[model samples]
Target chain A: MIMLLNECKIEMIRIFRNPYFVFWSLLMPIIFYFIFTKVVDTGVDDQELWNKHFLMSIAVFSVMGSAIMTLGIRVVQERSEGWTTWIKVTPLPSSSYFIAKMVGQSAVHVFSIIVIFIAGIILNGVSMTFVEWVSSAAWILIASFPFLALGVLVGTMKRVDTASGISNIIYLALAITGGLWMPMEILPKTIQLIGSWLPAYHYGNGAWGIIRGQFPEFKSIAILTVYLLLFMVLSIYIRRKQEAV
Target chain B: METIVEINNLTKEFKGKRAVEDVSFSIKPGEVVAILGPNGAGKSTAILMMLGLLHPTSGTVSLFNQKPQEQKVRERIGVMLQQVSIMDALKVKELLALFRSYYPTPLSMEEMIRLTGMQGSELNRRTDKLSGGQKRRVSFALAMAGNPDLVFFDEPTVGMDSTARKQFWEKVRQHANAGKTVLFSTHYLQEADDVATRILLFNEGKLVADGSPASIKQRLLKKAVSFKMDGHFPKEQFLAMEHISDVSEEKGRIVIQTEDTDRVLSSLFSIEMPISDIAIDKGRLEDAFEQLTVEQGVS
Candidate 1:
């Protein structure tokens, strides 16, 4: 367990050292929040709605960055460079190696969400009650599981070239459909229905609902949990097959 | 000494063609075994299977009487695969530290660096910045980091200069001195003759010969004897001797390949051939390797 955490700590350092991830996870969220809430503020009666919507959207974006894009790309690169096989030969238990990835991403997901939320408060004039803030943050962090599992599945299924292409498509689709790129209410009804089925949509909506002091939809949480389990199973099966080859 | 690895009728196929077929060999503790073969001779494939990176299509491979893929079993074996790439972005020390985390007990970072003869400055450099030979040295250090009892070096000295190659052989010897089992695969015949206690010759996916260098050399019947021959040399006469396998002439010199040197010499003396600068060349591992692979026609 100690060794596993050490590995995770090293991974965290490597991710922070990369400028690309830092831009997306830290700088982009602050920029997006500022533009949405401060610069493009369409004078509306309920400013609270705008605050909750964009804050939740930034949380959703955080999940996409840490859970999907960052984790997926790293796994593909590691496999291509034979680091996976190198790990397999070690005394480090395979389960520990895998669990460390999940733990590491969860930490990153929560950290990014907090940073975005605070940036919104400081720069975007976004404010919320203590209960609303706590629930919204908790929901976003809890919702990272499904995306992490999905990232592992896709990362394991393809090589570096295929993974990069597919990850971009998947990341963009989730960002748009999950309301990270736009307000969910303004999207087409067909897309709204499709969005409900995506883990990212549930994550975003759950955070959005929590920030409004409304109970999150239990159905979306259950559905996301199922997706998480399904992807984990698929990832294990695919990775074992890769090793067999 | 107990055997460290044993393979029984191991066979692996890709698509429909056999890569390694019905191969069986065993290596004992504190011994160095070299697998020598031409390209496409299935040497790398065999090593992969041994390392449990590839599953055998049929048959059994037991490292220390346990399956290679078993976690407990694998911990005892260290590998330097043919493809050597560390995390290019990580400094050498950082990479070593990460690999060290994987092992329960490992040599300290300082000791590992010292073992590989790496200077202090080299430890701080990123792997991508290192020269090819330096990268190989770092890989050698990583393989020994765990202080594993068994190490598989797949073409460990490939692309290395003469000095680097010599230094690597000394390391191999050091491992053996510490009672470590080593399975070295290489195309360099001299490496096998110099370092390996037993040479495992692979031809087209089968174990053709396994013995000490001297023993393997002696098993080949043909020897090359070269000398200057003078005055109406009865090339035909020497060629006809039943003991003589074949004879060839090269620019004022006669090279005879034969099993019975005395009988061939008797025939040559009878023909009144003046011989000067005569020397009997003991057959080498290179010659035996060629003869075996050519006869077998490694696919």
Candidate 2:
């Protein structure tokens, strides 16, 4: 248990020391929140309602981004750098290494979420009761689970450059198709259909449901859980294959 | 002597191409063993199998009388691979602490730093900013942090300067003297010659030669005797002598390759040639390594 926690502490230091991780996970997400909420006016008469919905969307986006892009890129880089082989020879179990990464990534997710929420309240004049804010934060945190699995899947990719490129493309596509940038009502019918099948859509929908004072759809939760399991299995399979090689 | 490591018919194949062929060896406690081989000779592959990082296609490896995959066995060993790039963002102290946590008992931080010769400021610096040699030193420090009973180092001094290499050998010697078993792989024949108690020469995925440096040199190279003579010398007479393998003249010196230098010397004195600058050269480990590896290639 101490070893696992030590690994987590080291991983957190690594993440924060990395300028790229800081930019993407903290700065870029905050920048995106400001641009979307404060600068780009949706002209919706219910300004507070628009602020609240956009805040949830960007929060989900940042959480997923950090989980997939930051965590996934770092894993692939470590593999390419031969750090994985070093860890394998140690008494540290593979499960412990992975758990450390998950915990560290979750910490970063919370930071990103809080930063975006502060931006919503300060810049866009968005208001919410303490219960609503706490519940929304909780649901957003829960919604990030599937993306954690996706990050692991991306980490198993062969090359760090390839992993980063693929992660960026996937992050943008998921955010756009899932109606985080625009409402699903505004996108084409085919896009909405495709987005419905994506884990990101469910993640955003769940968080948005919580913000709107309703329980999230059971179908969204179920779909997200299924995606999480699928990605987790695929990640483990690919990682085993890599190790065997 | 108790065997600390045992390998039986170990082999590894990657996509039908054998990386390590059927190879077997055992190491006793307190022995500093060097695995010497050229590139593609499967030195790294063999080390990987012994460390339980790679599963052999056939056969088994036991360390400390337990399977290599067992955590108990793994905890007793420290490893530094040939081509590893560590987390660049981590400070040296943080990296060492993380690796130290993996073992049940580890050396103190000050001891690890001192053993690896990591000085002040270097320990506080991030790994990425260190020079190549400095990074290699840090890697070596991490390997010794666990205070392992057995340590595996693959080309540990590749990027190190001559001074650093000397320090590394000294540390390995200290470890062995303290009853720690070390198994390392290197392309430097001189390193094996100077540091190893027993050398395992691998050629084309086979353990071609295994012995002390002097023994291997004796086995592979005939004694070389060279002398300068002022008077006329009968080269054919020396060449025809028993135990004399070859005789050649260069710059007024008669160089004789022979299995027995005593007989050659006796024959030379009996011939009454005015010999000057008589020098005998024992065969070097490099010659033995070359001949052994070349022989394996031909056969």
Indicate which candidate wins on lDDT.
2
Per-residue CA lDDT of model 1 for B1-299, tens digit only, reads 67799999999999889999999988788888888777777899999889888889998899998988888776687888887877656788888888777777888878788765777687888777898788888888888878889999898876777787778888879878998889988765556777888888787888778889666545543577788966776777777677787788878788888766777767667766678887787665354356333231122
Candidate 2 segments whose C-alpha is farther than 4 A from its true place: B223-299
Encode model 2's per-residue lDDT on A1-245: one tens digit a residue. 98888888888888888898778766776787788767887778887787799889888887888889889998988888998888888888988998999998787677778888888888877888898898889888877989989998999898988999999999999999999888888899999999999988899898788878889999999999999999999988886776777
Interface root mean square deviation per prediction: 1.7, 1.1
User: If you assessed candidate 1 against the hidden native complex, which CAPRI class would it receive?
Assistant: medium
**Can you write out model 2's per-residue Cα lDDT over B1-299, one digit (the tens) per residue?**
66899999999899999888889999999999999887778999999899888889998999998988788987899888998687778888888877788888999988877864677887899989988877777888788878999999998877666777778888888888999999998776667778898989887788888999766545555677898887777878777788888888878788898767788888878877788889987644344356333221111
Error of 2 at B187 (Å): 2.2
Q: List the residue pairs that clash in candidate 2.
A: none
C-alpha positional error of residue B199 in candidate 2 after TM-score superposition, expressed in Å: 0.8
Pick the TM-score winner: 2
